[model samples]
Structures are given as C-alpha cells and as structure tokens.
Target: MLDQAWFSKVGFDWHPHRGFETVTLVVEGQLEHHDNAGGHGVLDPGDLQWVTAGSGVIHAELAYRRRPVQTLQLWVNLPRRKKMSQPRYQNLRAASAPLVEGPGSRVRIFAGDINGVHGPAELHHPVTVAHAHYEEGGSFTHEIPGDHNGFLYVVSGSVLVGPDRMPVENGHTAWFPPGEPGLTGIEVHATQATQLVFYSGLPIREPAFAYGPFVMNDRSGVAKAIEDYQSGKFGPIPTTHR
Candidate 1:
C-alpha cells in the first residue's frame, strides 16, 4: 500500500522473515533503517532501500523528523527456488538514479529505460518504475511491454490514461492488464500541474502468505517464522527502537 505518514513515529520493531522482497522508496523527508544483519542506513528523497528477506533477518524503520513522511513500500513475490536464498539489501541514492526531461515533463527512471536512460535500482525480477511530472495541458506516452502488468498512481493533480479517458485523480491508482496494448497515453489537466508514479512487474504464479511485515509461501512458514522470532533466533533486541 502507498503510505502517507504525517509526523508519525512508529516503533514496529524488527522481526524475522523467511521469504519475500520488500522495496521501500522514500518520496519525502528522511527515514532510518537498522537491522541485526549489520545493515543500517538513512533514506532521503528519491532513495530506495530494498531488503530481500530470503532466509531470515531482523529490521526496523523509524521517523527521524517532525515533518511528514511519505513513501511507498512494495512487497514483491519471490520464486520458490529463491525463497530460502541468503538475505540481501540495496540502498540506492538519488544521485545514482537517472532523469529525463522534455519540454513540459520530467521522468525519473527507477528500474527501466525511458528513452535510453535507465535507473540504478537493481532487481531480481523484471520491473520498471518511473516518477513523472507534467505541466498543465502536458502529455506523454509510456511504452509497456507485452504481457506485463502495469499501473500508474496519480500522486497530484489529474491525469487521463488510455482511450477510455480514464480519469485518475490525486491519490488514485490505475492498472493496465496484460495482453492489451503496448503503449499507455497520459494527459494532465490542471491549472498548476500533475504527477504520477508508475510501477510494472512480472506476475508471480506462487501462493502468497502475508502476516504483518512477513510474507511467506504458506501458513506453516509463517507460523515457523513467528516461533523463531519469539525464540530469539534473529538477534537481541535493540537498545533504541528508532
């Protein structure tokens, strides 16, 4: 889910996980993430912190300022073969990402190519992420690969997608199914401007078992994870939750 936390401080302390990939993108303010696996850092605007909880790990995220925090956290499905692999993390900074600009639009590539530039966020699966900003009455077209499930989230102003002229307003999301077409057109209508974050990924064919920050293949795995954490298998509790 897309989360908008306004000056919110959460102590959802670290825990263990066996399978899945969590991608957290910071859109505004700052956040600090620490874990027992020797990974700790802070995220600023346009930064992406991805943790692949393959085998298991303990982690935490805390707000570090009084200003509101806006970010997107996505849970990606992992294939069965990679479910038990070793844990990994990627911290991508804003300078590492690529940006494309035109007459009335700006595009930031997070995982795929726009025109010819590509983002620096490494991926275990095929995906594309882009943040687009358009001036009033501006328009652009994004080419979607065949058989790829894609969606566009309007973060500000209003945008029209596809020939049906589907109206996507601020805080609304629009999805494009596979095998439909190769390109999706977007038009912004507002006195000021418009913005959207686009995300597309390969569809997984495996079952998903999710329980509050932990995602596994089945209920048994989830139960085992909970037991392991309670037994202190991950690590000792941190002195500060933040």
Candidate 2:
C-alpha cells in the first residue's frame, strides 16, 4: 500500500526487469507508467496495469499527481518455459472489469473469471484477482479452485473469513489453507464497512532466484539477466510517462 502523503514526492526511476510480470492496481489517486517497449498509461482509481517483462524491459512508474496515492503492486513469476517469450502490456481501465453486486456489497473482477464474468487482461498464468467493498453487516460467498493458493487482504476496516469466521483486521492478510482437488466455497462477512482484495493463483512449484527487479529460476539465470541488462539488452531507459 503506497499511501503516505510524502510518497507523492518520490517516484520510481527507470529500471530493468526480466523473467516475471508486474500487476499493479491503483486504489486511490493516480499512477503513470512508461516502458521502453513503447507502452504507457495513466491509471486512475480502480484501474489496473499488467506488464510482462518476458525476456527483458526497462520501465518506470510515478505518481500522476502531487497528492496521496495508494497502489498495490505484485510480481508474478513466469514459468521457465515462458521466461524468454515476448514482452507485453495491458492497460485495463476500471470500467473494463465486470461488476458483481450483492445486497450490500459489490465486486470488480479484474484479472480472472468469476461466475461467468471475465476480466479484460490476459496472462500466461492462471489467477483470480478481485477488489471488493462491503457495507457493515454485508456478506458474500465465492468459490476458489482447490489447486490454487489464495489469500484475502483487508485494505481497510474489518471482516470475518471462511466458515470459521476468522477475523482479519485492516492492513492485515489472511491465507486460506490448501484444499481438496476441487472448488471450495469461502465466505466473507464484513464487521464494518470494509474493502479488500482477493488473489488466488496456481503455484509454480519451481525454484526462484530474485534480485531487485529480476526473477529467475537459478543463480546462473539471474547472472545472465544482469549481464544482459548491463550490456543494454533490456532496451533503453524509458523517459516519458502518459
């Protein structure tokens, strides 16, 4: 969560990345992104940006305004098979998400299918990502694929998770235990007006060597990525933002 008012004064400069993808969600204010691959976008609240640095790429992110901005950024590893594929980007606007509304709650499916509603972005990995908001006393149930690992993060307020009603407070995260080989229904009951993000993904079950912006399967891969980056193989530094 990038929320401090002082954060507006700081910004990420040009950097290199390889062997992974970045998923960024703007929760408040705005974010501007740019990459050497010619991809650029300005993300407003509820918008998402997905960048796949398949082989390599250089990019930067900066606050779009001089105000408090809250953003969530995730690094999704690419399988070894697709580590050196082609680089790509997806700028998913907020309205592209499919909205699901219940009694006192609503959800925006941003990166995967939910109850037949599909998200706008396509990726190499299988994952379900959603942002949801609930009024006090609101409740909802969703099914998760058993083979995927899942977690619920309370962005604000409080909520009870699962049949056990495990309490998850603001700024905290709750992990769901591994389940059987099928879909499992999970319930959420908001104890107060709350907001949260749900993320579930199929595990890679492979070794990972991470150093700064690079994520590879082994040390040799990381070294090679570093060498290539130093050799100007990750493309030139991106200087502009949209």
Candidate 3:
C-alpha cells in the first residue's frame, strides 16, 4: 500500500502542499516529512498523519532508507466554513485505532463504527474507513447508513460483491451504489483470499473544482487559493528541507 493514497504513482515528491486534508495510514515501513510550517519528523508504521492544508500548506514525504514501505493516504474535503481556516495536523498511533477480530476475519477501524467497535478518527462529516482481512471463504456484511456513499478497494486477493457476485481484485476499487432509501446495509462475501479497505461517507454533493494542488468549492475559490499560495499566505518550507 506504499503511496496507495489515490494511487497517484508519484512516490511522494517535493512540492508545495495542497489545499486539502491529507490522512496518511502507514501499513509498513516509515516516512520522514518536511512541511513549510517548519514541521519535520519521522512516522512509523500503523501511524496516521492528518494534515489540513486549509488555506494552503507546503510539504513533502521523504524516503525512509530502512526498508520498503506500504501506506494509504486519503484526502478529506473541508466545507466552505473551514476551507480558509488555519492549517493543522493530527498524528495518531495505531494503538489509538481499534482492531476487532472474529473467528475468520479481522478489522482495524480508523473512523466510524464496525460491529460495535468505534474508530479513533474524528471528521467533519460522518464517514467510516477501515482495513479488513478475511481468510479464504470468509465473508462480512454490514448495513451502511442510507445517506452515505460507500466503496471498497482491494488491497490484496479477491472478493465478490453484491447479489450479482462481481469479482474485485487487487489494486481495483468497487464503488457500491447508494443503499436503498429504506434499507439499512449490504453484504460482501469472500470466496477466496481477500483483503480490502471499506470507506463510507455522507454525500456532500457540492460543486468541486481543482487546480493543481488547490481544491476548492468553486473556480473563484481555486483562484483565491492560487493567489494566496503565490503571495506567501501558506508560509515557507525551510531551504534545508529536502
């Protein structure tokens, strides 16, 4: 899962930070980071780094020469009220997240609730993010809130979703349709080996626009973000940061 966030395939580079929230989940290995606000440090596996690039922030992920690393980064969107707020960060260790285990499956939840176990993360919207591993022939099913959107990303192996039993493989993502207005949830079955990340969030359905690293609710907002970054509103990364 190294750099699995959005699967950009750009092995973290040195660039001005983006105008959004970045939640990084380290599955293996570690990372040293440098941010424009004079923030620099190393993150170990099972660690989560939540950075709000609010108005703007510049940062980069440095290579950890120790061993290979696996990670997943998810971008969280802020509402109009918070888009221009001060940038901030939240660093959470794995111990803070809850790992629930059953006879044939295990789940580590970072947000929302899973089988009565609550996660450690807090968000602006109601969302759930979890990593699940199921042994062969293991299956799991849960009802999603009717108002939220849900999807699953296969990290390893394969799984069949829905009544049609569609097969989703590694590196592939399957977005589930919104639950029925009166239904509570859906079911997922694993006929073979399987591991996946399931995420569900309340739909915002707001207009979204993006320009490079700048993400805004509208084109005018994007323009403001660009102007602010160029005018030094986001601050500066130390020249020694490489």
Overall lDDT per candidate, in order of appearance: 0.73, 0.82, 0.72
Q: Write the per-residue lDDT of candidate 1 for residues 72-137, one digit (tens) a residue.
A: 777776777777778888897767778777657777787865455677876777777887888987
Give residue 164's error in model 3 in angstroms.
3.5
Give all TM-scores, in the order shown.
0.86, 0.93, 0.85
Please, what are the lDDT tens digits per residue for candidate 2 over residues 108-142? 88876665567777979888888899999998776
Among all windows of 10 consecutive residues in model 1, the one with the lowest summed lDDT is 183-192
Clashes of 1: 0
lDDT of the structure predicted as candidate 3: 0.72
Candidate 3 has a TM-score of 0.85
Q: Provide the lDDT at 138 for model 1.
A: 70
lDDT of 3 by residue, 1-242 (tens): 12384222334655655556777877667776777667777788767787888767888775565346677877777777777767787777777778877556777888876566788876666777877888987777755566667888888888888878888888988886665454354566776677787887776677778677777898988888777778877786466654
- Candidate that would win on TM-score: 2
- Model 3's C-alpha root-mean-square deviation from the true structure amounts to 3.3
lDDT of 1: 0.73
Query: Per-residue error at 38 for model 2, in Å?
Result: 2.6
